[model samples]
Target chain A: MPSRDEIFEKVKTTLVDALGLDEDEVNGSSRLKADLGAESIDFLDIVFRLEKNFGIKIPRNELFPESLFTADSGFAENGRVTDKGIAELRTRLPHADKDTIEALAKDPRIENVEDLFTVNMVVNFLTAKLNG
Target chain B: MRWFWIDRFTEFKSGSHATAIKNVTLAEEHLHDHLPGFPVMPASLMLEGMAQTGGILLGESNQFAHIVILAKVPKMTFHSWACPGDSLLYSAKLIQQSDEGGMVEVKAHVGERLVAEGEIVFAHVDDAANGGAKIDQKNFVFQILRNVMDVGKAGNGTGA
Candidate 1:
């Protein structure tokens, strides 16, 4: 299995190719959407690239479940994620920064949930996926 | 002008690849209006031909059960120009496919000289379940290329 840094480098290269980002622009903390300016369609392209690069099969909805973030999912109330939502997100995004998710819950504006999808989050996800 | 860009499919393999040819003609009205004297076949139209070649391949993979639209163009590059009297051959290969969408890597060539190369993204819409509301269910793409597809089928040894 590749080391976490090795995996991160591959992930970073994939993001740079997929999203047309400069290498310096991406890092452990950069957000996929907010910081890196990835649109929803780019998610599909990124997943494809990841699968090809890692030779892994990722089933639909395994990562970046955009539908879950919608207001109608009962995951959030008044655009803020509720405790129930946070719990659900914990279950859903096990590889994400749990502390960040928890911290955001204290000031959980619904949009902030999207912030959990930073560069490190993907590296973490791949680390677990490959090591396991 | 007729939205159908490619004249016909020269080669087609279900769920894999397809090659279609378009014969650029000086008689095409757009060429007359596009610059009047130097009637070069626009790269944009050649890109459409590439998409059509790939789109039909994708749509037929699912038997055209869903509405497939050219959803995105992530990469495209033109290396040479195609002009009147030139035959543009568009070859498309399926790169990836999932339930919701598929991607194809396509190239447009004028007899060994590469004109353009790119990747295309297509989305499958289950109109009935997704509430497309007022989408044309007949699929304009299939409607236009129906005859050409028949020709391809006949040439494929279907004999009908």
Candidate 2:
């Protein structure tokens, strides 16, 4: 199994490839919508890329907001943002929460973003199934 | 272009049935991206076409009382790859129906050659609620399909 940092790096890379963003723009702190300018269709394409890259099905409802978030909520009305939004972002990370996701994002042991998202998603899914 | 369909229904008691055709053309964009020179229709889209045909069949069977949406494609198999300039035919028959969901068996063929076959499961849904609903047979579904297939006529049969 890959480390969380590696998964994060992979996820970052996938976001870059799927969304067609520059490499420098992707990081643990990078906001998906605002900084990336990803739209609804782009978000779905990102999910498809993640699923194909990791060989796991990420449910659509889990990745996108139930409804579009407004600018008043701190997410740019157009859907961009900062590291603070990372907390809410965890809820959409396939099956992750704030603390575990934050640890993975911050973990120096991780090397790539792909492994981070994959590991986090798999572990979180497994843990949820085991506990639930 | 080629078309593939499962079965041909000449006549039915209550439910509705229909046929589908797909024209495989060199002009299709996916042909280039799927492979360098070898082009095959994406299986997912083929399944979608089958589901669309099936949905129409079920809707017509129940007289359009409910709209049909594909809830799942649990199992699918591709016996042969359809290439450009081939015509594919798909025929579907309603296996079962109820207030919840229904199943249909669809087959695809290129001329007399069997290309692919699979079973599609769908739910009868209300256009308003966008979910499952009970079907009413006396409405529009059966009437539409009967007219399209031209069943009950002596000489009109599925023409391969």
Question: In terms of TM-score, which candidate is strongest?
Answer: 1
Model 2: per-residue lDDT, tens digit, A54-118?
66654535544533234455533233333444445555554644554566456422222223233
The segments of candidate 1 whose C-alpha lies over 4 angstroms from its true place after superposition are A70-72, B128-135, B139-147, B152-160
Q: In angstroms, how far off is B132's CA in candidate 1?
A: 7.5
Which model scores highest in lDDT?
1
TM-score for chain B of all predictions? 0.87, 0.68
Q: What is the lDDT of candidate 2?
A: 0.57
TM-score of each model, in listed order: 0.90, 0.41
Error of 2 at B89 (Å): 0.6
The number of the candidate with the highest DockQ is 1
Question: For model 2, how does the per-residue alpha-carbon lDDT over B1-160 read when each residue is reduced to its tens digit?
Answer: 3222222343343475667776777787777787686788777767766776677677767776665667655457888878888877877777656554566778877899887787676664564333335445335342333344443345456653
Error of 1 at A119 (Å): 1.5
Please write out the lDDT profile of model 1 over residues B55-128, one tens digit for every residue: 89898888877667787788899999888899999999997888877889999999999999998888777755
- Provide the interface RMSD of candidate 2 in angstroms, 1 decimal place: 12.1
Q: Across the candidates, what are chain A's individual TM-scores?
A: 0.93, 0.52
